[model samples]
Target: MGGGCCGTLVAVHLLRQHHPAHIDMIDERIPGRGLAYSTAWDDHLLNVPAVRMSVFGSEPMHFLEWLRTHGRPDASPDCFAPRKVFGSYLQDVLNDAVRAAAGTCRFRHHYSRAARLTYDGRVARIALVDGERIQADKVVLATGNPAPFSLEPAVPGCFHSPWEPGALTGFDPDADMLLVGAGLTAVDAFLALQAQGHRGVVHCVSRRGKLPHVHTLYRTLPDSFDAAGTGGARGLLRAIRLRARAAEREGYDWRAVVDSLRPVTNDIWCGLERCEQRRILRHLKTWWDIHRHRMAPEIGARVGAAVASGRLVVHAGRLMGVEPDGSRLRVGITLRSQAPLSLSVERMINCTGSDENYRRSANPLLRSLLESGRIRVGAIGRGLETDRHGALMESDGTASGWLFTLGPPRVGGLFETTAVPEIRKQAEALASYLFSIVREPEDVPVDYFLAAGI
Candidate 1:
């Protein structure tokens, strides 16, 4: 389990509901935060704004309250506060929830990493990196986003992923750095280098060379676009296409159409057949992305400034290959216009977005589950396929009752679930399910097995 947003929220909800089970949150929750909501770096800020990022629908001002209590004098209403502050808000909620509990369930935190997890009869055995294991009736896979996709092997002079601190370790500030894939993560890498006073040239490469667009705070947000009301995938596309055209005529811009479609994205996704989903993914995914997931206003400015300063270059191309060139690396890339370009750089970081291409995560756990026919991947390849109730279905068309998934792994199952709003909802639902099965002896029976001993 994590102490991040998803993990903390689940613990909070379970305590509030008085769920029966011992809860051990294994994360450096008291400090250091996490890779996402790091306060150590003041430059790091939350991607989401305060108004919309709430712990619960009923308590919309919970986070704002935390800010008032802890950071009131200095924090601005419109400020994209440092992400670490958000973590503090979450930790505060957890503390208060436990404080107010009449008969709080067994709750504690183990500040250690989960080395391995395996099923043990009706209970799951969790082994920690510090050589400890606990038996629990149910397990939640809430390990937030995993490490970023690697652009190259972990060889010297090649920075393969942004999140790994080792990549940035002892990196020469003046050496040229190449960033693979121009996306949000690439922006983060650029910002990290900027914050670190790295004055090297940052080259970002992608097929369209498209970076995330800025978020425009429109005065009047559009009403929800009900694609399901139209009935099917064709109808959904027709509705969006028509709305986009009308928005263009009204000078509303494409943003409105995309924003309006947010609430109904999952509906449209689930409504479509497998073939239709592929059609949309292949032909329309990119067009949809550049308009949808927008950047923070301040962050957007920094990215643009990097370009203007000639420190960052966005190249529209395909990476042909990269070879080690004594003390540096030569990257062969094919551009759309130019014949071809081969550049030598001290390092290359792959900010290529999520390895939703599941197989690519190269995760032993996921691969084991897949090969055992205990889990099935969805159309987008981002996560395990499950029903509305969140059953981990197998490739042989069977649902495994013992295993469940959480976080972005269910992106295909819920389109908006990657973000906080949707993730909180999922965590609540998952907690409810786990609580039911844990206390109700033999009810909701699962064919669970144990791995004997670790």
Candidate 2:
């Protein structure tokens, strides 16, 4: 359904593996250009290095190799490529796959939003907003990230998502602006404002007021910690801290220690009890995110300079209130261990990252599925519940045979589901699973319909 990187990866794998008879992608945005990669700002470089960004995990150097032959002759594996370039790479990969399977596989893209979905045991039918309906043997919800949760007592001039096409437009260049959430999203908004010639002071507020760490040249270390031996969340934290310190003492960066856990993160996450998983989300998620999802070195340097110049201010606090003040907004916050503070700003944008709470999702298709008891919320309400193969779990706790998803939709079950490295593997495995059960070409009737987004 989606035409983003995740959906593109799945489609490519499906075509290459079995040349499925027919596949339809549903999305309004151009294929492969999801919110992350469609940015107009060239400053928005990918957080992961080129070497690790391949859509095919088995071909780890595919993306880097593609860059060298396509425009960037001097590209290196360690360099951080602009997300815009990555988007193009994904589009090219899908295009080539479609061309190669032209005779065997039929492909189409519906440039519209999926409004509703229904299944009658054997076939899944999707209703589009444009009064069109399609039936498919299988459906994959690859709708990337959802919009950020809306704030209560909504006020004018408050944008819930910075990725919206014109979210930052029309703001006064000299008026102060506030960004809610000081994670990677906030970093992106800050850099975007700079690129847009905004000279106003930008304030970022979050519970921890922590910024993402910067990437550095470091060798990946081999796995040494015993996750199974670690009893619970606290023990896991203690073990990681001890390992990080040991690595530092051994003249290696802590990043090496963190990277070493990549291969086994899902195993460790799934091994924990539900309560233990909740504990990690409540206490350690923010800290883990800052360290694990770092900014490119160049972006880090720019952010550091902004902080030094005092144009960007970070606060550890909770939003107290927000009220309109004529042409601006009066925002109140209770700073951590400090007195309450108030600021008047021309705009406020939500950069808290994606809203993983599918129960409250504004997407009509998800809403319909929830209301009809076709899907249930996942662990800790992070995302929809799914089995190991990304099959949606119905309200009664049985995995659906025809409804499936990947990438962000699988986050609750697969802790490391969003990145290309993890998602590509999922796509490949998912394609293989579908291929194993697919009918012969003569009997295939719309093999799958991919609904991309809200």
Candidate 3:
């Protein structure tokens, strides 16, 4: 029910497939732009290059071609363009598809948040926050990542998520601040603050004070590891380490070894038992993320400079306590094998990234669905449970006939579903399946579900 990149990509595929039916997208923000792409800061560059970030999987060079024609004439395939440009590209792609399907298909965008959803026999009814109701034969929950975890005490100076509009505003230029993570999100926050002329020292604290690795040109290695054949997480980790060492001995970068696993990561993840998966998430998820999701070279350089200059402090610690001071906040932290340390900061920003645990999500739509047993939490409590084809699974272990999802919501089933490469393939396959299911345009009627009682 989102109008973000996932939803937009799905709509584009449906239109391109010539689905002669009505399609509706619901979101309060600008269509084709979600939390990740809504940023206007140029320093928030895409971690992936233009060539690998296409909305259409079949058209690998689509984004690169678009960049070249749209004000980036000198853009190369490996160029990591500003994220805002990609947002505009998505908008243009949606617009082009809409124009192409002008007479054959009907499309509408609802500028509202989805509050509830109900399915009765054949039709699915979606209730909007503005009291609007719409019915369709199928509904796809393309809602991207959930918000960051809400910290306790609800202090005034604490920003729970840096993606919120004006989240970095209202802070003094010379006031020291603290970031509650040391991942890619934290790096983005630091860059945004720097762009805003925030000259105060920024303290970044996390369980492991390690930032994402930098991207570099490396040789593409052939597949040498059998991820599916690997016994478990430990076996997979050991194999990767061995392969990385071998590659290093051969004068190849370990990054290439990691990159080579892209095709088999999901296979390995799915092959593991739930307990094994839990073990990986508990101990190795952070390490995998730092390597899998890297920073742009330019971004890495800036962050390195900041760290070298001591303006950015990295603490491998956990936040012990936070109490409000008169004009600021007093934060307590405990580093590994170190004594307790305290700091007073003017602001604290939560950059821990998206909270994938849907069980604790406070979104009205998800709450409604969970309460009604329309959808269940995924294995290991990571994301929503979905079948291989992206169909949602109900509380009773039955796959939903009409409800489906893609992107971040399918994380538990497909560990690597969030990236553009994976999501584009999903959108395409889901669109084809949807097309096959509802072969005739008249299969879906215009009547709303009276049982919904909206």
Candidate 4:
């Protein structure tokens, strides 16, 4: 019950295929922009190239074609356009799908938040924050990423999420600002501030202080890479290193080797045991993220320039504490293999990115479902438990035919579910599965409908 990219794309797929039913899309924010693309900053470009960002798997150049039609004749497959443009494109596609549905199918947009969900062996009931309830034969939970983790004893002049409107507003352009993470979100925050003419030092601290790798134009890997043969995390690392060395010998960049892993990442991840997954998360997740989730070339250049010019300082440390310091905040940090240090900053922003733990989520709907035992947390304690087809699993270990999910909610089951490439594929597959299971209202048990008290 979301209207972001995942929800919109799934809806488009279902509508285009003529799903004969009424679809209710719900979200408190705009349907297409979601949290990631709602920004007004033009400096924020997509991480992936345009050619690879299509919503349809069969048409890889769909996004490029859309760009060309929208006054961007010079746009090529490799160009990384502003994220807002992509958001606009998504809106256009959703509009077209809605128009195509005509009288055969109905699409409704609900500008509200989902508060709770309940199932009674047949139909599902969804309650909204406005005290309205809706019943459906099937439910798809596309609720996207959760908010950033909050620190205890909320400190003034500190922000937990940078994506909120006006979160970075009203700050002095010349005042030093501290960022709590050095990943893509941190990079986005740095660029957003720079775009606003912020000239003060941007101090970024993380466990490794490692930024995402820069994108490069390179050829794809050879067909003999054998990514599936890697036994576990250690074996995968060794194999990638070997491939990187061989690619260097052939005068090719190592990026091609990493990109080659994209098609088989889920396979490799599924082959590993739960302990192996935890090991990767503890030791190699950061390194893998930096390489796998590289930034756009242009954004990377700006970040490099900022660091080289002493305007951005990145440190490898852990945040010990943050206390009030009269007019500013005193941030305590402990660097690896070094003594603790303290810095007073005018403001601190938590660019630490999404919190994957569902148990700790503040969303009422998710908490309700978890507490009611309607859905069980994943084995890794990161997201909801789901089968291969995105069907949610109940606490008693049975797949829920009435409930499904995609995107970040399936990260624990599918290691690479967040990106566009993987998500679009999931959308298409889900739409196909739902279409196969379409049934008449009479086919569903009347008792199931009455169980929701609708």
Instruction: Please tell me which predicted candidate would have the highest TM-score against the true structure.
Output: 3
Which digits, one per residue and each the tens of the lDDT, describe model 3 over residues 87-202? Answer: 99999999999899988887889899998899888788888899998887889998899888887756878888887666687689999999999999999999999999999999
Q: Estimate each model's TM-score.
A: 0.88, 0.96, 0.97, 0.96
True-vs-predicted CA distance for residue 56, candidate 2, Å = 0.9
Inter-residue clash pairs, candidate 3: none
For model 4, state the Cα shift of residue 172 in Å: 1.3
Model 3: CA > 4 A from native = 439-443, 446-454
The worst-scoring run of ten residues by lDDT in candidate 1 lies at 445-454
Taken over the whole model, the C-alpha lDDT of each candidate is 0.72, 0.87, 0.88, 0.86
Worst 10 residues of 3 by lDDT: 445-454
C-alpha RMSD for every candidate:
3.8, 2.9, 2.3, 2.3
Query: Which pairs clash in model 2?
Result: 1-450, 1-451, 1-452, 2-451, 2-452
State the lDDT of candidate 2 residue by residue for 292-379, as single tens digits: 9999999999999988999999999998888899999999999997779999999889899988888889888788888898988886
Best by lDDT: 3
lDDT winner, 2 or 3 = 3
Error of 1 at 251 (Å): 6.1
Cα lDDT tens digits for candidate 1, 353-380: 6767666656655666677666778756
lDDT computed for candidate 1: 0.72
Q: Candidate 2 — what's its lDDT?
A: 0.87
Rank list by lDDT:
3, 2, 4, 1
